[model samples]
Target: TTVLTPDVLIIGAGPSGAAAASLLRQYGYQVLVLERQHFPRFSIGESLLPQSMVFLEEAGLLDAVEQAAPEFGFQFKNGAAFLRGNERTHFDFTDKFTAGPGTTWQIKRAPFDHVLAKQAAAYGAEIRYGHTVTAVDVDGETPCADVVDEDGFAYQVRPRFMLDASGFGRVLPKLLDLESPSNFPIRRAVFTHIADHFDPAEFDRNKILISVHQQHPQAWFWNIPFADGRCSFGVVAETDFYAQFGDLALDDLLPAILASEPSLSKLLSRAEFDTPVREIVGYSANVNSLTGRHFALLGNAGEFLDPVFSSGVTIALKSASLCAPLLHRFLQGGSVDWQTEYEQPLRRGIKVFRAYVEAWYEGSFQDVVFAVEPQDEVKRMVCSLLAGYAWDESNPMNNNSVKRLATLAEICRDGRAARDALGQA
Candidate 1:
């Protein structure tokens, strides 16, 4: 057996990369983290789901997160049919998900990434800020990285394993030639932070709020209130949904959504934005194949579904946790079995999430009639499902979605049968 170089080379110093590096270091392994950007950069997807609380505790960053984030758990409002609009539907995890008062965080990507990166460094993982990974030398039996620094000096960090936790599938996937195709179906989101006096209920505990304005299937917007009295609002429009709006800028997207929703229209008409609108082409799953002999990808680098549920943080940390044990075993003279453990379950999770996202796509959730409606059973079920409760194999796979999907599927069947009979007549 030959000796290897560094224990782990983590690409992308985002939350997932930081978690993997920090955890590996905690168990006594030499880890290196490289990031293309410095700390405190602008990022999107502010609202987080409840399951993320569990993962943050695992990463030992829970305390830090609580300090930086507001105390709001999660609230699902709007998205009801006209008949049900009198009473809005909301989800308080305290009611169901009995994992001991679990609550998620609404974090700005810049500060969140900065905290995680610094924590990883403090845990003894060597972190290089502004150092980008140009290429990876996976040809060797022990895969290594061909990296370039700020000075354009190229060198090799020969590590036993490489982890690409880069959000948006940066290096490995492209190198693996994992191109995201149009059939993949993506959405264009335009978001910005606004500080104009919107008052949530008094009992909200200053916690971040996740607000979904019903637009039906074409597009839907979100409002995530942070601890700083500012709410991050973004609109997710289906591919080419904004094609006709070319004359309009991103800042106008939110106002457009508000105009379509009576509730939001009144609320935001009195508000002002704190920043310029930022746009992103997001919520698309990546090509398969996350594992190779010496390199594995994590987070969005591997699989990214719609942000409707705020599962980005949870997905990355969850995947990293799964990889941790395997990496641990290998580090301790134990064999790493990629086939039995990593590949199969990974596939299942990805498929389950994809199916769930597809449902949202099909329904379009953008219809003002359905979105701004008050409390109703179907609306409750929809919100529960959206806020990270689809009940996949990881959690208790809820029968709710299957039931709803089945009910809808049957209606389609019945309608088809009637059509056939009429044709015969």
Candidate 2:
């Protein structure tokens, strides 16, 4: 029976919501963020790309993040390492073609998100936890939401502009019927945290390791290490591929799959899988429209391609950084084109990631990554994309990613075949 109005209403105090609130507040807007969950709640997507640091810095939250590094056990990360059978390759973010921060942290999402939300609140943004948006109406001039508190109190919030940053929750997408089937095929991931015990020299704790299944080209594992001797390990494969396992419990399932990847299995042999194994099926999603009226969707609320590249948080923060300024301009009575200024540009970066994700599953990118002799310039460009510089227009890979990646892949494969023929000769 209460009504509250804010200049901007952000749903979900996750990365995107927190970043947007901070950015808008910096621009002198009154921002209210509603989060259904409390701080320090468990969440996935533990990896962070270098590009995320730019947004955190711009939002004035990077200082807080760096300050929390020791307390939160934030792991130092400089690059990513990949493995398949006996071949191995790594991309040092510092060697990338892009001109930006070359290193970032491998984070625990729970603490990372809490830090961001807390910092945003410290910056004068009002953040209400345990408040869920049950209904949304954006058809009118002002976008509003019917929210219910934990104590059963119900209220309505009307804001001049609304942003949905509900990662995977997709609150507005579900409420307003903006959901669309993702173009990528259905996939699933089974994961858990482990008290990883490894010799410092044996494994590179500073880099996330992705190991491909020797037998199943479509299956892969992500080993994301944390500074506190803990690591996140997960396996992703097409949904039907898991059907063969047939209702096996996660505890039994994950270890069984890990046994198939020799390198990962040996590396994790002595590690403890302390947490309960978890599974997420069909996580890839999309939206029919990114914005309407006074509202727009940010991060996973709009579209989610895949987790293979760990692009979730980067995209979430990118969407926030891109939208805050445009929304600020509109609030200042300046004409803004949401389609061209926001959606199109955002989707362009997304498309670049999409092409890589698709190529990843199709095996083309793997060939490019593990090539016997990849060109330094080409590798640097690929490293830029991997570093989450997808929006950089100067990068040739950003334009026509699918075609360019395909051509590069073909060239790598041909060179590989020629080398094999010479070896036989």
Which parts of model 1 have CA positions greater than 4 angstroms off?
1-4, 70-87, 97-101, 180-184, 201-216, 244-246, 364-404, 408-425
Q: What 10-residue stretch in candidate 1 is worst by lDDT?
A: 76-85
Clashes of 2: 0
Instruction: Report the C-alpha lDDT of model 1 over 1-425, residue by residue, as the tens digit.
Output: 22336788899888889888878987899998888787877667666666655666777776666665443322222211111123243445443322333355566777877777788888898888788887776777788777777888677788878899888746898876765552456677778878746654421423333344453444665666666666777777776766655567667766666566666555556568768888777557665577888877788887777776576777787778778879888868788777567756655655555555555556523222133223323433334444454434323323334443444444334443322221232
Q: Which tens-of-lDDT digit does each residue in 198-250 have in candidate 2?
A: 77877899898988988898999999999999999999998887777778899
TM-score of each: 0.82, 0.96
lDDT of each: 0.63, 0.89
